[model samples]
Target: MGKNTWIALFAVVSTLGACAQNDIRPTVRISPPIAPESTAMAEATVTMPPSGYLDYCMRNPAECPSSARDATHPEPMTPLRWAELDRVNTMVNASVRYVTDASLYSRQEYWTYPNGRGDCEDYVLAKRKMLLDRGWRAETLLIGVALDLEGLRHAVLIAATDKGDFVLDNQLEQVVAWQETGYTWEKRQTAANPNIWVALTGDAAAPEPFEAPATQPILVANAHGAESKPEVGTAAPAHTIRQDAEHAESTPALFASTTDAILTIPTPKPRPLLTARPVSADTFSLSYTTETPVIDTAERGGAINGAS
Candidate 1:
């Protein structure tokens, strides 16, 4: 109501406004969510199928047809289908006793359905057969070859589903995703034709180009057969080592004095240990006279009689 009161109220409003304007809060930066792990493997160049698979196909014509299927694609995986896969994988793994082809049939390699005992290939065939009997498509079930953790050849049944590719292995009881198997995939049956195989490109990358060392190290060997690298100059300019006698003789002489000094030089080896020279008869007589006392035979006899 009074002038001073009104002035005080205006001052309070201005102070509040300035405080609100000056207020600063820390800014938070949120990063985008991390993407899910990739679960699929890509097919590379087509290649030859395994020899054992061909033999098995020859025996069973109905299973391996030469013609390609039109509706070849990944099957949509459901809970029931997943359960069925697990059941087949576990049952076959338990029932079959692992026996090598050499021990079982006196052959190096063979692929066939297992009765009670069989090899890895046989176990794969038996699982595929059981899955086929349970109304699964042939295209969905693919036979795969891979190198195990120990880098040994192995066989497994691959189930191609919408979610991801899963492996049904004779060595494992649980149906596992192919990516988590830790095996280097080599080849697998193509979806178009069960008999034809294609190479798998799983996380394969082109090798990095080789780079020359920035500074060449000099390796110095010790008396105890151990070697050490000493700090040395940078690598020489790109020049080929002259193998010819004329160039080899000329290049080394120039290398030491050149502005761009070569990192390495051939160390001059010391002459071999001084060996005793084979002496002639004259030299031998001279050497003996100089070093040893010479006495006449009569004098020597006289000295011997005196001693006696």
Candidate 2:
């Protein structure tokens, strides 16, 4: 049996200078869940980093170009250079495939045990480092993200580019055009010092089990052999899109069922399923249709909790 390693830490490290004073640390649970992760795209010359990307300013202050006055260094050397980065992205994707098990860290801090690679956040770290070395802006690009009404800890790259804001996610490889990632997002900064993302939502979660595609009744033959419409409620495939330059948050429902014994098909009333697109090395996205008609609820309430 796998040993359960747990730490109940009751200390929060959020206080910047406060860490110096009232050192009341938050009691944090050590066994964290699988983190939601992302990636970036072909756009380049990250010089002048996109707006609000400064939080990840520089891995090492000395190595980064001091001051934007000589800002042009961050710009992509050429349009073709983006292509070169694409080729280099193979490592990030390979790293994702290397480690299939969930690890207990985010971005660069996550563990890649026994010389293997994986864990959602780790994918983001590898991609970011590659982009930076390729001359992408240090301050202009950061792992940016926001949670929804449901408190799942989803992460995305906030690329401050001359073109505009873009999101990079591990769910797909195509760079998203920011506005197109679909989720209602709020601006956020990455916690890279020790390598973590600070929660934008204090303690609220989006909702349980991210939304699944709407179900159209499935038709099955009843035991009696007569053709009957058994109210077989089945969901459609979650959609995907490579549009834009952002990494999209992906839920399990987004992918088609992998079961080998079953043959699943869509309903006659088909809704559009966006094509899956790739970005950087560790991200992907596909747009899915929710129950278009809003769902009604009972008077009694439902339970909610944080996803991280």
| Every candidate's lDDT | 0.49, 0.31
TM-score per candidate, chains pooled: 0.53, 0.34
- Off-target runs (Cα >4 Å) in candidate 2 are 1-78, 84-91, 98-116, 148-151, 190-308
Off by over 4 Å in 1: 1-38, 204-308
lDDT of 1 by residue, 17-48 (tens): 00001111232322113211225567777665
**Residue 113 in candidate 2 has what lDDT?**
15
Leading candidate by TM-score: 1
**Model 2 reaches what TM-score against the true structure?**
0.34
